[model samples]
Target: MRFALSAFAALSLSSAAFANTLESSAGALNITPMVTGLDAPWAVDFVPDGGFLVTERDGDLIYIADGTATRVAGVPDVAARGQGGLLDVTVAQDFAQTREIFLTYAKPQSRGAGTALTVARFSEDGTALENSREIFEAAPGFSGGRHFGSRVVEAQDGTLFVTIGDRGNRPSAQDRSNHNGAVVRINRDGSVPDDNPFVGQSNVQPEIWSYGHRNPQGAGLDLEGRLWTSEHGAQGGDEVNLVQRGANFGWPVISYGEHYGGGRIGEGTEKAGMEQPAYYWDPSMAPSGLMVYSGALWPEWRGDIFVGSLKFDYISRLDGGGVTEVEQIEGDATSRVRDIVEASDGSIWFVSVGDGAIYRITPG
Candidate 1:
């Protein structure tokens, strides 16, 4: 028997109660609190029927509806340590008909823990997960508890794109034998797509779509269906990149930023065969969740990109091409934004780990 654990009282703040107006280049943005008192919430995605599925890094999945936050059952055990834990959640494209969802977590392993992907069906009542299964696990789980790049994005063709971090092992990003620091494309059942770049290649993980990322915590598709990732640099090289097929993104090899204590990182910023970042931050902001806007509510923002900042308490709005930081949506509520997404109604929603709440942003 599953239980409905009350995570917190959903504090739906009225417009008058939300005092701080967000600073933005476009205009003053209004932010309202939707839910409060969450415990280290990491990611959030909308349910097809007008609710939210939120993942807490401490291994809890909470569902908020009509001012009540209930804990959902059947989430897999996660290695909730350091940056590892229940990471990301996304509903299926045909969620109303299929009731399917995808989750990424830090799966406990013999060595330590590794990022993993799972597929499950939500119950009709939204109280429990009916069928749960692990689809993929990044190889050779390292011991230390840092750098688990675990974001899931559904491609246009219904395939899944899962991201993994280097697990603090810089050299692993260049290794073909493991899934570390790589983007993998796989089928619904965890099968490798035959057309994947590394498929059929010797000594390579067949599921890899791209490699050499440092720690891509956020990923999303643009209006044209192009995939983009927001990655963290060691000290200052935080970047946004257009992920490509089998392309090598220079990590330890070449970086625009230097070492933490200040030293040249690689041969140089530009290198042969390695892909360059679309945009980068010289002073790392620790970017997390990513979303490409459709401009349904704000026509001017169509095709623009929104990125949540974990280190800085704000959302960085990038230009349509993902090449420039055009705006910084900041306010009192914009505290340690861990995830950001565009809702069905065109309103922007984000998860704030620092505030322990979920906030909705709209044009003021």
Candidate 2:
């Protein structure tokens, strides 16, 4: 029922099959297919052992072991509508001891659907998930099918940081009363951390770590444990932000890009008390899936930020402390790059929506 291509076999595939090699500033890279036959895979995360987990937007959690794909049971029901579905999957920090994993998806709700976080246990046999539990759900679910920024990141302190988009509602990003257009922080048990930015506030949602964002689809932590996010702009204002506690990222109120049609957006891009982006793409690269490289394989590229571009079909390597675009790794295999992650062995892996498969990159 599944086709699994081994790495050795993938390396032997001719250029006619896929882009076999890419030339980056670092060197020539061999792009090999790690797994194929995925249906709109959104995110990929490695397990402690030799296997990995992948989430399909259609709501299947597939575990890839020894080059085979097996559907794992116990995934929570997802909205599975336009732009809303199974999103990101992350292995828990204490996975070895707790066997826990985290997932972010568009959860069905009364008003419509909202981004939600769920905790589940990966059974010992790695074929099924057990004890699945919904931990957090963004507030005031919207009916729109766009902008569910649901990337899950495990912070250094073991807390989970989940990004929520503006849900196509501009003003809500600035409103603290709801989780819309916000990056929320919560404990694994779904409880608000006492030190959260808005905690104890009378009207604010305590889970919000930061607010005022459009559709931030990518998020990660740097070597220093600082949080960062990649966001989509309307026409040309995509952004990469260095997330901070209680900081307000001016979304609709200020943007480097204009609306869909040519028109000004938000006070000409600068506003008082609003944080500016670390880096932005004026022509809209449509960035998604962020990763802070440890340089495990390429020491020279340590501390660089790698982001997949859905619009450009390439991987962007940002350096100069995440404020500059140093290199663009592009190839036919990088079609509609959705998510990019580093494996334990230092190989870089990414999901391709256009190809409906996963590929790994290594120094050639």
Candidate 3:
């Protein structure tokens, strides 16, 4: 069931080790880039059969089988401009029996106005989405198109972990009344969980699990069942944090990153009440997608975290416990990495935002 990259095509790039790289040698890693020429690929999810579903920012869902991509029809309309557009997608963990899939997109309102982060479920029948239903929608659509952190992961108890961006408003991140810039835990049916952090709080949405996030794009669960997320900071200080229930992560209030013009972001990098990041980067890689590798293909990388970077244009490898061993791997280096998914067979698949290509990386 495992997919193997041809050994004849091994390409090794110069090691651009960051502060997080392991001090000891961990053996060689060979990465081979497979498939090119896509149009802004945002996310990739494996189907029950051997194929995969790849979403494009320009409103296209491509079905790739045997390495050839075919466009699927009946995709809903998307804003498809600036930072808004068709975004992440995930197949239900019980997809083999249910054929259910979830998708996130920027729902367009006016000609130029839109609110990012809408989740919908659909049934797949070869080349189209059938029985599509919008499960959740962000409130108070914003005008500008930036900071739409829309990724979803199912928890062990069947609750859905949904990441929502700040909607270009920094103050809203601290506002408990709004859903922006917070991780919301809800039932799979889009209903707020009764046991949510702010369930009985006045003016606060019961779905808010955690708050004060600038822009969280990637989320995943470790083998220990701990939830982890990667958020983009202003100019520097991109972060990886272990998500805790009801924890407030300081965004504008505190950040290791300064403004693009070198202005102070908030009070400081650490505040008394706010939770600090588990790890942060200085240059801001603009991490988009995250996945933990426990696959057999890369035994040396087992239990490691693989993060796809948009600003750095590479893959960052981190040790399981936290951020340890950061190395920029080459594959679709010309494009921004959108999402990383470890296949059932242990091969890693990545989506490119710039060119929309889906690249499969395996041991060469």
Candidate 4:
């Protein structure tokens, strides 16, 4: 019966749990499970002392140190509902000295909730944060818990680039007057940058850096400080874009995807004055995390882009802008690859939400 087969499979997997490795076109990768039993971990950031700080979408912040996963206190209360919760984590460039940390989450409000960014100082013992404060809360706290695209990038200049999704409102992606569907820029203290694209414009939010994104959960800065983002489309048309200043990325106006019910969306994928995607996926991978790799680990992979796929349960390795996908790495443990980052030792680390675990990819 099916029960007998399921039991056999569980026994087989348990016996090989310690030696789980993923083999792909790249080669054999030794997969090490840093931590397990997480409630849908969203992202991970490394600290200076060989430890990791992680955020779970169910409103928990965890510290992985010396093979133990400990829940850290001081995380803000989150609207932990459908796709809304604590999402991304990042450390300050000078963390060894300042001990500052940044995170993005769905901040609860009376109207509903909105994506918000916060800054805090990590304690020395990795137990709690000090002086935590809300740095930026996206405008128009929405009613639904869907599409809070809360990815963040700490720019080289100490400024921040935060992506807020359209809050499930199809039309809001084209509305510049609100913070939804926009990449916002602000200083570390949450002050809007004077040179932002919409700073002096009327009927547009000053913090807007670029607008018209659908739900970009992936964001990263290239070596040259250029931002890149990957957004989820409705049915198909998942896109990877080179995010730029003062530019409008067509969303509802020009999508290659269709509505959930098979209806056409936008102006048929091309329109004047709207920026086209650097690349797009037709069948939809639900791309989440984005990272431009350095040659430190794989010399040939320098400048190669790695994006985690939520829908496809794989990692897509891409070339330069407008380039096609080169490869996808997948295995049983690579399910729902939510976030990807480069470690100090040059290994590629990613989180598997389906497994409630974190994994690392290194040269075989």
Instruction: Say which candidate scores most in lDDT.
Output: 2
**If the candidates were sorted by their lDDT against the true structure, best first, what order would they fall in?**
2, 1, 4, 3
The Cα error of candidate 4 at residue 319, in Å, is 1.3
What TM-score number comes out for model 3? 0.87
Distance (Å) between predicted and true CA of 112, model 2? 0.7
Report the lDDT tens digits of candidate 4 across residue range 1-364.
Answer: 0012113233334434554677765578777666666678999989988789889899988887654556788898999999999999999898988999999999998899999999999988888889999999988647998999988899999999999999999789889888999999999999999989888889888999999999999999887889999999999999999998988898889999998889889778889999999999999999999999877867777888899999889999997644679888888878999999999888889999998877777776
Full-model lDDT, candidate 4: 0.86
1 or 3: which has the higher lDDT? 1
Query: Per-residue CA lDDT of candidate 3, range 107-156, in tens?
Result: 87653433333334344446667767666766664668888787888888
lDDT, candidate 3, equals 0.75
Off by over 4 Å in 2: 1-19
Using TM-score as the measure, name the better of candidate 2 and candidate 3.
Answer: 2
Give the per-residue lDDT digits (tens) of candidate 2, residues 257-327: 99887999878888899999999998999999999999998998999999999999999999946479999
Rank ordering of all candidates by TM-score, starting from the highest: 1, 2, 4, 3
lDDT (CA) for every model shown? 0.89, 0.90, 0.75, 0.86
Q: Highest TM-score, which number?
A: 1
Question: Candidate 4 — which residues are off by over 4 angstroms?
Answer: 1-17
Give model 2 RMSD, 1 decimal: 2.5
Give the higher-lDDT candidate: 1 or 4: 1
Candidate 4 residue pairs that clash: none
Question: What is the C-alpha lDDT profile of model 1 across 105-189, one tens digit per residue?
Answer: 9999999999999999988777888789999988865878988997999999999999888999999999989988899999989
lDDT of model 1 at position 134: 95
TM-scores for candidates 1 onward, in order: 0.96, 0.95, 0.87, 0.94
Model 2 lDDT, residue 145, Cα:
85
